[model samples]
Target: MSDIQSYKQTPKYETFSYLPEMNADQVRRQIAYCIAQGWNPAVEHSEKENAFGHYWYMWKLPLFGEQSVDAVLAEIEACHREYPNQMVRFVAYDNYAQSQGMAFVVYRGR
Candidate 1:
């Protein structure tokens, strides 16, 4: 799906929701960049229409440590398939420091 043109108009009670940081074409490269930097990728989703409704619901998932890019790609693909209607995200974690590096709100519904 394309980015939400307007967040408040699209879903939630929030007055504003940030725009997507990564466009479609940039996804793979950005994921690869995060992996190259040794960050682990994980997925999460919010079921509400205004995703922030009831507070940005998220999945409690394990980190993908030292996983191959293919594995990460496969997991991301799975996330898209699993949560086709909800808002999903791909977040990279720096396990060494145990903190988030970066994240991309998924745009590909395929």
Candidate 2:
């Protein structure tokens, strides 16, 4: 067996894990897409060590029927400020699909 092939890689967290960390504009665009789809926006946070865990603490209730991307971005910033040492994620819930349509880490823990 090849050692390189046998090496266990570290597990990555949610969406966009394989890609470079998103910049502010990219995050805003994603939130805008969610809003455009009429999905609800929600924020969640967790300790960096537990980011891969099944659950995270929701920042607040999901923002339903919110149209402005700025509002969602503001909420993300607020969560980041409140939990600077923890990972913060932005999630979009699709009511029609009955599940999360999109989710990604907005802020990595220090």
* Number of the predicted model whose TM-score against the real structure is largest: 2
In angstroms, the error of model 2 at 43 is 0.5
RMSD of each: 5.3, 4.5
Least accurate 10 contiguous residues by lDDT in model 2: 1-10
> Candidate 2, residues 1-110: lDDT per residue as tens digits?
23222124644677775566788889888998999999999999999988878999999899989999998889989999999999999999999999999999878888
Pairs that collide, model 2: none
Reference-based TM-score of each model: 0.63, 0.89
For 13-40, candidate 1 gives per-residue lDDT tens digits of 3222354455655777877888898897
* C-alpha local distance difference test of each model: 0.64, 0.87
Error of 1 at 28 (Å): 0.6
Best by lDDT: 2
